[model samples]
Target: MIWNTLQLALREIRRNLLRSFLTILGIVIGVAAVITMVTLGNGATKSISDQVSSLGSNLLMVRPGQRMGPGGSAGAPMFKIADVQAIAAQVSGVKAVAPETRKSASVVVGSRNWSTVATGGTRDYFTAAGWTLSSGRIFTEAEERGGKAVCVIGSTIQRELFGGGDPLGEMMRVADFSCQVIGVLASKGQSAFGSDQDDVVIMPIRTVQRRLTGNQDVRTILVSADDGVSTDTVKARVEKLLRERRKIGENEDDNFNVLDTKQIAQALSSTTRVMTTLLGAVAAVSLLVGGIGIMNIMLVSVTERTREIGIRLAIGALEHEVLLQFLIEAVVLSSLGGLVGVALATGASLGLSSLMNIPYLFNPGINVMSFGISALIGVVFGFFPARRAARLDPIDALRHE
Candidate 1:
């Protein structure tokens, strides 16, 4: 009896192929939109986390001010080079410390001039930031002590300034001072926030203090913890030490901020997950609309097949069999639409993820869940029309046709 009912349902659907396709169109679009939005949003969140992790495995950032962001501290005292030395000497579990200061400068090698940020830090800055030298060597200790006019170039600057030629041992003008390029850094494409991490010139801290900015104030400090040390533990230690060094009373708030890359990644990932949920919810509204479309079409199908239904009843077919047939048809239609939509979404996700410069992650759980929900929608909505067809009196249904 079940096989017979399924055969009848398939026959009815096959007889009106064009109409069937049109009815299921809503399901296709709805499923595709939901899957595409979720897949892309997840990829974006993963990309953010990956980039943040690439900054360093165990890293802590210390800066003046009670908060972090673009806004500078108005009354907060900037950190001095002595602070970097103190942190290095006093802090336990610390692998390295890099005190940094930066300013915007125009770089020139003869007529090929380009504008970029000029940064000054000790060699530990590279180690703390997980930077590698592509070629040449880091600034010598003697050069660092003497405040020598030497610098390293990032990948972007190397490309923009040197083209195909080697930049090693070349003299480039940074602001008013001429500096020799001693090394080139390996590529670190971009930050999670979309800033070009490689668009900079790096020199020793003293060089920038004397030549460019003419100040001993440090803007940021990068700290790398020793192996197996917890970043949170390092952050806590740094905070406690700074609070004591700054002479803040127990009740008074410390004037500096200690942040780790893991904390930043988690915060950003949480925010992104919330946004993804909202987008997915918005996309799900269409599935409800699609369910209504399936219901409406099923109602029309029952009306047109009223005569056939009467004949089936006259031939000793049970009313429940007829009900099951219609319900099955609805489920088949919705499930088929879901499968096609998943295929479409997979293609779209691959293309869009590449265009957006992120990874394409396949989520089998979402695919199965979406397909199951679509079938469930069909059952819930198809019940009304199926029941209406089943409850029709044979005489009345025959008379109407």
Candidate 2:
């Protein structure tokens, strides 16, 4: 009996194929939009986490600023090599510390020149910054102590200045001084903030201070904590030590800021998730609209088949059977829409993820839940029309043309 009723429902839907397709269009669009938004959001969250992790594990960025941004550090005293030494000596659970300064300068290699950022730091900078060389070596102890004019170039700089040729053992002019290239850094690709991480030149700290900036100021200090150590603990300790070193009174506001990369990752991920939920919710409104469409069309269908329904009732067909047939038709229509929407979403997610340079993360749970919701919508909305058809008096339905 159930199979026969299902067959009758399919037959009725097949008779009005065009209308059936149009009826479910809203469901298709709603499902596709929700899935696409959520998939992209997940990908963006993963990308943020990966980019932050690339900065280094258990990392803390200590800057001489009350805030972050262009002039947030204005009127604040700059740190020195002594501060870096003090942190390395006094801070427990510390793995390495790097004192860093930066200058924007144009580098010339023969006829080719590229404007890039030049960073100055010691060998510990490599460890703290999670940098590794693709070729050659870091600064020798003598080169570091003497502030020799030698540099290591990032992948972007190497490509721009040297093309496919080897950059090692080559001399490049930076600002007013000539520096030999001792190493080429492995590519780090783009940062989370969308800047190219590989567009840089690195040299000994003293080299940048002496040849480029003509200063002894350290702009930033990077601290890497030991594995299994809490970055929060290290950050607090660094803040305390710096306060004493900078002579900030107990009631005075801090003159420095310590940023933890893990906290940054969490905050960014949470923001993306909230956005995803909002977008998904906005897209879900169309599902309710689709359900209303199903109800309206089913009402029209029952009216058009009124005479047939009356004949069935007159010939001993049960009222429940007639109702079940119409309800099944509605479910089939919605379920079909859901399947097609899933297929469309898969293609859209793949294309968009590639275009956006983010990963494509498929979520099966959402797909199943969406499909289930659509099926349930059919039952909720289709019931009113189905019940109305079942309750019609046989004599009255037959008399209606």
lDDT of 1 at 244: 81
lDDT of 2: 0.91
lDDT of each: 0.89, 0.91
Writing each residue's lDDT as its tens digit, candidate 2 over 135-207 gives 9999998999899999999999999999958999999999888999999999888888889999999999999
In candidate 2 the C-alpha lDDT for residue 144 amounts to 91
What digit string (tens of lDDT, one per residue) describes model 1 on residues 277-392?
89888878998899899999999989988988888778877889889988988988888888888888899999999999989989898788888888898899888889888888
Winner by lDDT: 2
Which predicted model would earn the best TM-score? 1
